[model samples]
Target chain A: MRIAVDLLGGDDAPAVVVDGALRAVRADPDLNLLLVGPSEAADAVIAALDPVDRARITVRPVRDAVRMSDHPSAAREASTVRDAVAAVRDGTADAMVSAGSTGATVTAAALGLGRWPTIRNPALVATLPAVGGPVVLLDVGGSLEPRAGILARHAVLGAAYAAVAHAIDAPRVGLLSVGTEAGKGDRARRTADPVLAAEPLPCNARYVGLVEGYDVSSGARADVVVTDGFTGNVLLKAVEGAYAMAGGPPAGGGVPRAAALLGVSGTVVVCHGAAVAADVASGIALAAHLWRHRATDQMAALLAGHAWKGHDHIIDTEVTTP
Target chain B: MRIAVDLLGGDDAPAVVVDGALRAVRADPDLNLLLVGPSEAADAVIAALDPVDRARITVRPVRDAVRMSDHPSAAREASTVRDAVAAVRDGTADAMVSAGSTGATVTAAALGLGRWPTIRNPALVATLPAVGGPVVLLDVGGSLEPRAGILARHAVLGAAYAAVAHAIDAPRVGLLSVGTEAGKGDRARRTADPVLAAEPLPCNARYVGLVEGYDVSSGARADVVVTDGFTGNVLLKAVEGAYAMAGGPPAGGGVPRAAALLGVSGTVVVCHGAAVAADVASGIALAAHLWRHRATDQMAALLAGHAWKGHDHIIDTEVTTP
Candidate 1:
């Protein structure tokens, strides 16, 4: 499979991204990368590769890269991340990976690839390896405002993604809140709990009312934990910090630095902006895995089959302005 | 110092509470406790203690206990937590500890002990042992909705709390957000950032822009991390879960099960509803330490001296309706 790599995306862009691209090509023989960035950065990756593997590496020269200080809408400009998305849009690459600002990557992908009809806001889903199994958390920097409709829609996306990507059958979906009981959270949680419960879930997923923060790391309560982007983003980082404090992560694994962006038409993976070389490499691998499994198309079909017919009005009324 | 203990508060209440009270009296010879609950539950504590130590324990019989299912307003009734607050109010106990519904405990404490005039919302502060020092996090289940004024006030409470409770000098206070960069979080965080920066802090505290979830556990950025209660609550629990999954906590300590409530007139410590016997014992210890240090009185004086004179209009206009 071919993946477009945004070499000028991370905090240590070009250097780390070049190192990551070299590693990805070496690790997977069948994997090919279309490096999108300045000519020098792409050359850094190609120069390091062995002559035999150079055939698997391609370059799309784009000088301008999105900086962290730039606004998300800056993706509208001709930047590396936008070009990476364009590569996937034009069928030059099967998927794309970026370690730029999450907002910029989301904007570029949503604008370039177009979003799924039913999904108003795209979600960034991160999977944590827990005791029982992997726990899928969604909207981890996508939609910040905690509206009931957004949460419900994300819940659907999460369940389908868990089933398609992770091969979890009949995933147990839970709404992340302060407490596990109904009406246990703030106004948004209280409003979202019932809406999520009433909404029909795809892939035989069942709504498990409300779950607390502990459930996110334990993975004993639910497989798919849905929350607003703000809480999910902070919680994910806090867990990463805790693992570091405890010496290291559990045998299962550490918190993921890369998250799959759902709701966009093409497969996309976003690495943490401060991600290391290994993190970027893993992000490229994630993008390849998703493309190989046809996860995005499968999730789209599943969602289409179980559309929010009963909750269309709520979704329509609560379309948040970015 | 005498502390009022709510015997019928937690999930395994009366039993764990009785055990916890016994441990507290045994550990601190000078400590005295006023047990508020059924006579049998109080007697259970006295029966387990030595004859000499038994004198340190007194009972105020109140059968009605607010269950988790009950509304937080139910604290207005003569429940065990309410009675415990009354004991503190009437000077029978210098402080109070409860392993009950946080909302109910906040309600009982706020109503019986009264609130500080400048602070409109009461904040629950938890201290985590970090690499540098103890990191103080506030509003862990107090105010859920994220109003900029409430967050700004919480930053003040957290800063003073670190200096007074944890003995951190010139505590570096930070507003918790998705990223350390300015304007990187949700609308609430974006609005609160500048307000907190402009607000004058007590105890030589200084605002350190925005810090991420990693700062909360690492304590590398700020001694005090401030956020709305919803985010704080989940972040704390998620950290706890991560530690558990990683085998155990670091040598410094684990996530605190007890949090000190600020903005109330009397010293109050609220434990996790699912607290164990050890957690309850530690909570009682925390309350005793606070009372001995006169933390509540000191914080109130500090807040009063450095009142929100510059931001009074914002505080007055954004008074949340509980």
Candidate 2:
């Protein structure tokens, strides 16, 4: 399987991205790369590779790619990121990776790969390696509102993602709130609590009502934690910050730099804009892993199976707007 | 100054309450207590204390109080918390402490003491020890919206409270959001960010623009961080959880249990629902500190000074809803 890399993304541009690409290529012998960027960036990777290994690499040289400061729409269609998506859209590559602006990567993917049925907002799924395996959190930086309907959609997405990607049999879904009590949260939460209860979840997932901030780290209440992007982003960082305050993360666990962008059709990964070389390398590995497992396709199929009957509006509009 | 404490508050009621009360009395030699609950509870406290120290303690027998399982409105006209408020209302006590329920304490204080003119929702202000000094966070569990006008008013309330309570000279206020960048937040935050920027802060405070959750722990950006109650409550707990995960807090810092209820006409302190003996004692100490320093009165007087200008509606509505 071939994976495309956006060389012009992230704070540390082509140099770190180039270094990360070299690392990822060496780590996974089965990995074939489509270095999508300017000539110098693609040449940098080629020069560092042995002749035998260089044969496994392909270059799709574009003059430019989506810069972190560029508008998502202004990213040239022929740039590495957009062209990388086109490669997947044309089935030339199995998956793609980017460390660009989250908004831009998301925009390119949602526009190029298309979205699942009834999925208006695309979710940024981050898997935390908790004590109970991987706990999948949705809308990590997507959909930043607490409308019951939005949360309910995320519930289905999280459940399907868990079943397909992590191979969890039955996921327990929990809505993040201040307390576990029925009426424990603010007005939006009070309104969403019952709505989340009534909504149907995929993969035989159970709704555990309300859970607190601790659950994110411990993963005690639910395998699937659903929240709006606003809360999720703040919460994810806060947890990372807490880990920092605690000196570091719990043993065998730490904040993830790479997040899988689900809902858009192809296998795609978005690394943090502040990511380092190791982070970008891990992101590439994650994309390759997802592609190997056919995680995106399987998850998409799972969601299709549990797709809501009449709420096709979500699917038709925007899938990964977060 | 004398303080009245609800004897039947919190999940671990009566016992924890009794233990906490005993600890508080022992810690503060100048403290006088009015234990408002059952006569048996009051007698139990009286029994625990030495006869000599018991001279400083008093009891007011009242059976009614809001239970965690009960509706908050139960603390309306008749209850132990109401009586405690009444004690302060009638000059029987200088201040009060409760760990029973936030809604109940807020309601009791608002009705018993009456809201300060122009303040609709009274804010719960928690002071976190940051690297810089003390950072005051308001609306920990009060309001949960992103109204620009409310946030503006909260800036004023936070500024005065920081000065009067924390003794900070020129408090810097900030709007809590996902990112520090100008437009790095949700819709509500986007609207409130500029509003907070344009509003005039009291006590010589200034707006430092948008800040992240790190600012809350580090206290590097602003002295007063304001947000809706929902975000604050979750953020506070997340910080507490982080401290726990980290082994302990920063050398001399930990999560705060005592929060001062501002925007009301009387002096009130609310402890965490899971208050331990030290939490209760610290809460009582906070009450004493506020009263001894006349912090509440000074805050009120400052409001009175700015009553006609800034925001007359907020003056009567909420101390700050930002």
Candidate 3:
């Protein structure tokens, strides 16, 4: 299977991306890679690789990348991310990965691959290392304010992804809130509690009502925790900050530097803007794992059974219209 | 000044509360206490005090206390928290402190003391330990929304509180968001970003665009960080959780176990539900400090200057009606 890597992505791009590519290619003999960026950057990786394994590498040359100087919207015209997405659609690659501007990549993927039937918002899922196990947190930076219907949709998506991607069956789903009370949290949360309660879940997943912030670190309350992207992003970084404050992360792992973008038609992984070589390698590995599992297709099928009828109206009135 | 203390106010109530009162009374020579709760619990404090200090203690018998089980609405009823608030309102006590339910304290305070003019939602503010200095975070559990107007008002309240209570001059105020970019963050943040920027801040506080979770811990950015109650509450708990996970806390201090409830007509500090002896003592100290500094009155006066003309109306119309 072939995967496209957006070489001109991340804070320390090309160099880290090249280093990660060499590591990913060396680790998986069956993995075929398409480096989608500048030839000079691709040459850096090829020069370092074993000559005999060079046949597995493909280069799709693209100029100009999303730079720190460029506007986030400039990513639309950057060409690298869009080319990466195109490779997936054209079947030249099974999946793609970019550690670039999240908004840019998201916009590119949505425009190129087209969203699923009911998913108006694609969710970015990160696996946080916790005491009990890895806590799968969704919408890390996708939709900012999720409506009741969208939250219910995310719950279904997160559950199926946990089962198909993480091999966790019957994943417990939870709504993140200030308290675990029946009626706690902001207006949207209070409104969505009843919706999440009644919605049907995939993979035998059950909604565990409200869960607190500590639960994200403990992994005791739920396997799949759902929240709007805004809160989820800050919470993710806060946990990372906590680990930093603690000298280092716990034994299991640290806050994931890479997150899998679920709900898209193909497998995609995103790294932190400040990603290092190790972070890039992890993102590549995560993308490969998702591709091997055929997790996206499986998750999609599971979600198809749980259709949300009231979602469109909710989005139009509650979210989009404003 | 006589301060009524609820001996049965926290998870380690009575024992810790009694121990805490002893510490406060001994530490602050000018302090006089009116221990209100079960007489046996109040007796614990009297028993620990020396003969000279014993004369300073008074007991008010309360058969029932507000349990963690008691709903927030119960605070408006005839409970210890209500009684504590009433003592101050009726001129029997100068101020009050509780380590009981926050919702209950908020309810009791709003009902008994009445809100500051035009202040519909009173906020909970906590001072976190930061490397650069103390970072004053607000709305730890006040209102949870992105109303541009309320956030702007919180900016003023936070600034005034910093100047009066924390003694920070020309405090730098920041709006919490996912990114530091001008247009970064979800809808509320995006809208409120400009609002806060345009707000005529009090006490020479300046708006410092957007800040992330790191600023809250490091205090390298704005002195006063403002966000919706939902994010602030969860973020505060998460920080406390982080401090615990990191093995105790930083040398400077731990996450403040007690928070000062702002936007009310009087000085009030609410401790954690699981507050220990030292935590209660600190809460009492915070209340005394604020009272001594005339912080509450000054903050009220500050709000009076920048008061959102119809904040309560907005709360009633935008939140409760839905």
Candidate 4:
């Protein structure tokens, strides 16, 4: 599968992105990278590859790029992430991977590749290896507000992603809150709890009452954890900080530095802003894996078959303008 | 100062609480405990101590303890926590400590001691040891909804607590968000960011723009980290879980399991519901430390002298009922 790489996305920019592209091509023989940046950066990857493997790489070679400090509105301009999104939209690449500003990437993806049917906001889904299995967490930073409709939609998206991407059967979905007891949490959670319970989920997923922060890493209580982008983003980073404080991560692995952008028509993966070469490589691999499994298409199909008839009004009313 | 101890407060109450009380009395020669629970539980602590040291222990036997599963409103009944709060209200005890339901303790304290001037919701402030110094996090579970005015109040409360309790000079206060950039969070955070920046802080504290989850564990950015109780509660637990996932905590220390209730008229500390003997002992120590320092009274005096006159109307309208 061909994956578009945003060479100007990360803090280190061309250097780390080039190194990551080389690694991604080597890791998978069939992997092809459409390097979307300056010619000098694309040449760095091409010069590193063997003669026979060089053909697996392609260069879009766009000069103008978005800087980390640029406003998110820069994504609308001609930039590396926008070019990468265009590659996927035009079917030149199977998926796209970027380590740029999350706001820019989300804006580019949602605008370039139209959002799926009932989703006004795209949710960023991250999978962490838990004690029992992989736990799917959604809306890590895509939609900050946790309205009942947004949370209900995230439940369905997370469940479908878990089933299609991770092959989990009958995934147990949970709303992340302060306590497991009923009627716990802030105003948004109190309003969202009942809505999630009634919302129809794909893959035979059932809504578990409520789960706490530990459930995100332990995976003992739920397979798919749904939360507002704000809480999920903060929780993910806090877990990373704690691991750093404890010296390193546990045996399973470190906290994921990449997340999949769900609800967009195309496959998009966002790497952490401070990601290094290895993190970018892993993000590209994740994109290729999703593309190989056709996770987005399959999940979308599952969602299409089980649409929430009365929930459209809820989404329109509850989802605030960003 | 004599402190009231709720013997039936934790998951393994009476046993853990008795052991904790015994340890507290032994650790502080001047410490005295007014144990509020069944006579049998108080006797265990007295029996464990020497006859001479036993005089430091007093019992206020009240059998009906608030169970962890009971509704927070149950604090209105004649439960152990209610009796403990009454002991403080009637001037029989200088302070109170409980490891029971946080909601119950907060409710009882707010109702019995009365809230500070211009404060509607009390905040749970927790101090965590960081590389530079101690990082103070507020609203751990007190006020979940993040109103701009409430957040502004918490910023003041956290800054004053850090100065009065920890003696941090010119503490740097930060509003917690997904990123350090301005306008990078949910609606509440976006709205509160400007308010916190403009709000006057006590103890010569200065407002830092914004901080991420890592700042909570690492004091490199800010000394006082402020957020809604929902994010703070989940982030604290998630950090604890990450530390557990790793071998253990860093050399400095683990995440704090005890938090002090701010904005109330009396000195109170709330321990985790599943606190152990050592945790309970440490919580008692925290309460005594606060009482000895006269932290609450000093903070109240500071607020009274520099009240946010125009902000009271904002709090009334913005503070949503749970």
Candidate 5:
């Protein structure tokens, strides 16, 4: 499988991304990389590999990259992220990975590949290994201000992704909130609780009423946790910080630096902007794994079985707390 | 100083509360407690102490308690939490501590003690030990849907509390958001960001723009982090879960079980509902520390210097994201 790697996507771009690409290419014998950045960065990867095996690597040679501080609209212009999405659209790459700005990547993928039916807000799903199993957390930074209906839609996406990607039977889904009680969150959570309860989930997943932050790491209450991108992004980073404070991660694993972007009609992985070489390598590996699993197509097929009109109904009942 | 203890509070009440009282009384020679619950629970505290030292303990003997599942309005009735608050109001206790439902505790404290001047929404502040110093987080669960104005008010309270309670000189305050960029979070954060940056902070604290979730634990960006109650509450618990997942807490400490309820007339500490014996003792100790430092009164005095009228302007600019 060929995965497009954005060479100038991270804070320490080119250097870390090049090192990560070398590690990813060396780890997987069948993996081929389409380096999507400056030629010098691509040469760094090619020079590190054996002469005979260098044929597995190719270069797109894009110059500019979207900065972390740039607006999402900046992705509309020429950039490595936009080019990577185009490669996926043209079927030159099975999947793409970027350790750049999450907003830019989401915008580029949604614009180039197009979103799935009825998914106005795409979700970035991350799986953290828990004591019980893998816990799926969505909208890590995809749609920062999703309404209740959008959150309900994400519940469906997360359930389907958990089943297809992780092969978990009857994944238990829970809405992330301040408390586990039925009505214990802000306006969005209070409105989404009942909507999610009524919405039919695919893959035999059942909606657990509500879950607290602890459930994200323990995975005892639910295998899948749905939240707004704002909260999920913060929670994911706080967990990462806590792991760092505690010396290192547990025996299971550390926080997943790579997250899958759902709703867009392609396999895409977005890494943390402050990603190290290992994090970038993991993002590349995650992209390859998702592409091999055909997880996106399977989730779309499962989602097609249901009639999703929650977006239309969201306008009437959305909460305005002012 | 005398502190009132809600013996019927928490999931594991009476048992842990009685044990906690014993530990607290043994630790502090001048500390006195007014146990509010069934007579038997109070008797357990007295029975464990020597006859001469038993004089430090008193009993209110209120049987009813607001359950964790009960509504916050339930605290308005004749519950143990209300009685404990009444003891503080009547000069029998200097402060109060409860490990019951946070909603019930906030409600009981707000109603019984009354809110401070110009502070319509009370904030629950928690102090976390970070590598740099003690990072103070506010609005943990008091106001779930605070407007930008309320968040600005919380920034002031968090700053003062950090100075008086934790002795952090000229603390740096930051508004919590998805990203550190100016316009990176939900509507509330975007609205609150500029308001906080412009609002004058008490105790010489300065606003440091927006900070991500990792700052809450790292203390690398800001000494005091401000957010709406929903995000702060969930983020606190998630950090605790991360610590638990990483074998144990750092050498500094774990997520604080006790949080101080600001914007009220009296000093109060609310422990987590799932608090253990050690957690209860820590809550009692925190209450005693705040009372000794006169944190509530000092904060109120400092706040009097500012003309906090942000609440009046919130209605006009609050985002209605449908």
Candidate 6:
């Protein structure tokens, strides 16, 4: 399958992205890339591949790109990210990957692919390799100020994504908080705990009550961990930093620099802005895996079976509550 | 110096507390402990020490304790934690250490010792051993719902703490957020960024703008990282978990099971409720170090020189704002 790659995303754009693109294409003979950026950057990738493998690369040739300093709304402009999303919309590519500003990618994807019904806020789900299994963490940078209902909705998304993406049956979903006990977090967590427990989870998943930060890396408490964008983003980075300080990650793997953009209709992956070439390559590989699994569509179908009534009203009320 | 030990605190109360107290007393020749809990638990510690070392331990019998499930305010009763606070307040001990519910310890300490002027919320500061130096993180579990003013206040606290506790001169203080770029986080961070930048820091410290979670372990961005108690607590635990997953902490040390309680008048140390005997001993050692350095009083004296005028008004307005 073909995946659209944003050539001018990330801190060291073009060079690292091109290098990553080459690595991913060479690693998987069947993987084709729709390079959406300046022709020069795309040609850089094309020149590196052999004549027989060159046909796997196609150029969309968008000139402008959203910079790291640009606002999330800048994706509305004619940029590489926008064009990459457009390629996916037109079926030129099965999925898209960008190592750019997370906000911009999320904005472009939500606007271009359309968010799933009953999901006002999209989630960026990252999987951490734990001893027991993979621990899925969500909202790494999607909705920053999620109310109780939004969190409950994310619980449903995380469970479905875990089941579809990782093939973990009956995933135990836990709300990330300061403590594992009830009423151990700020106002947001205190309100969301009961809401999550009451909400019906898809894929036979069950809410495992409140969990502490230790559970994120240990995976001893839950298979899926749900948190607001702000905490999840910071926690993910902190864990990565800790692994770095400790010399290296466990034998399993380190924190994935790429995260799936859930709640959108199309398959999209957002890599960390500070990602290196290997991280970008992994982002492309993750996109291909998700596309082949049809994980996004499968998750949407699973969510459709679970009715989420009255959540919107509850979220509205909670948001307006001082 | 004498440190009051909360013998009935922690998940595995009495047993671990007694074991920790014995370890602490044996490690420091000049260290003395005032045991506050059931007589049996105190007797166990006294029984373990040699006759010559027995004088280093003093027993204050109090059978009741604030259970993990009890409300933080339960420390108001005649529990071990509350009695430990009384020991500090009455000059029966120079400092106190508790491997107990953080809420109970914070509440008890604040009520017993009185809060420092201009400091409404107490802060629990933890230091992580990074590659370059120690990175001091504040408000680990002291103030959960901190407004912008509280965060700005914490910046000042963290700066002085790094200088006094760790002897890091001119510490670079950074606000923890999702991204390093200006205006990259939620409304709370966006509001607090400028406020922290504007606030004058003690110990020749300066604000380093926003920093990501990686800075917490790498010490690459700032020596002092400030955030609300909720975020700080979770990040600390997550980093600890990461270190555990990576085999062990870096050669320096792992996440400290104990954190220093700031913004209160007396010296207090709060250990993780899941703390083992070694963690309790380290908490005692931390308390002894602070007592020797008079860190609590030094921080208060330093803060007194900095004008915090108009902060309360801004905090009130922001809290009331939608």
Q: Which candidate is the best by DockQ?
A: 1
lDDT tens digits, residue span B101-204, model 4: 99899889989999887888888999887777799998899888888888898899999999999999999999999988887888888988988888889999
The lDDT, on a scale of 0 to 1, for candidate 2 is 0.81
Error of 5 at B62 (Å): 1.4
DockQ of each: 0.72, 0.47, 0.43, 0.64, 0.59, 0.62
Residue range A1-322, candidate 1, lDDT tens digits: 8999999998999899999988889999999999999988888888888888888988999999889889888999999999999999999999999999888999999999998877767889999988789999988988888888888988899999999999999999999988887878888889889989889999899999899889988899999999999999999999999999999889989999999999899999999999999999999999999998999999888877876833563356432222
Chain B: TM-scores of all predictions? 0.96, 0.95, 0.95, 0.97, 0.95, 0.96
**lDDT of candidate 5 over B3-44, digit per residue (tens):** 999999999998999998899999999899999999999998
lDDT (tens digit, per residue) of candidate 5 on A1-322: 9999999898999899999999998899989999999999899899999998899999998999999888877889999999999999999999999999888898899899997877766789999988789999987887777478878888899999899999999999999888887877888888889989988898999999899999999999999999988889989998988888888999999999999999889999999999999999999999999888999889878877776657565334332110
Cα distance off (Å), candidate 5, residue B306: 1.7
Error of 2 at A149 (Å): 1.2
Candidate 4's C-alpha runs over 4 A off are A317-322, B317-322
Q: Is candidate 3 or candidate 5 better by TM-score?
A: 5
Docking quality band of candidate 2, CAPRI definitions = acceptable
List model 2 lDDT by residue over A1-322, tens digit each.
8998888888887888899999999999999888888888889999999988998788888876677666667554667788888889998889998988887888888889997766766778888766666788877786777777777788888988888778888899998887788888866677778877877787788889998776776677889888888888777776676666556777756778788988889999998887888988999999998998898888888777774632542434333333
Error of 3 at A32 (Å): 4.2
In model 3 chain A, where is the ten-residue run with the lowest total lDDT?
A313-322
lDDT of 2 at B310: 34
Model 5 misplaced stretches (Cα beyond 4 Å): A309-311, A314-322, B313-322
In model 3, what is the error at residue B237, expressed in angstroms? 2.0
Chain A only TM-scores, each candidate in turn: 0.97, 0.93, 0.95, 0.96, 0.96, 0.96
| DockQ of prediction 6 | 0.62
The digit string of per-residue lDDT tens for model 6 on A1-322 reads 9999999999999899999999999999989999999999999999989999999999999999999888888999999999999999999999999998887888888889997777766788999998779999987888777478878887999999889999999999999988887778888888899889989998899999999899999999999999988889999999999999999888899999999988888999999988899999999999999999999889889877877743664346221100
**Poorest 10 consecutive residues by lDDT, candidate 6 chain B:** B313-322
What lDDT does candidate 5 reach at residue B28? 92
- For candidate 5, the lDDT comes to 0.88
Location of the lowest summed lDDT over 10 successive residues in candidate 2 chain A: A313-322
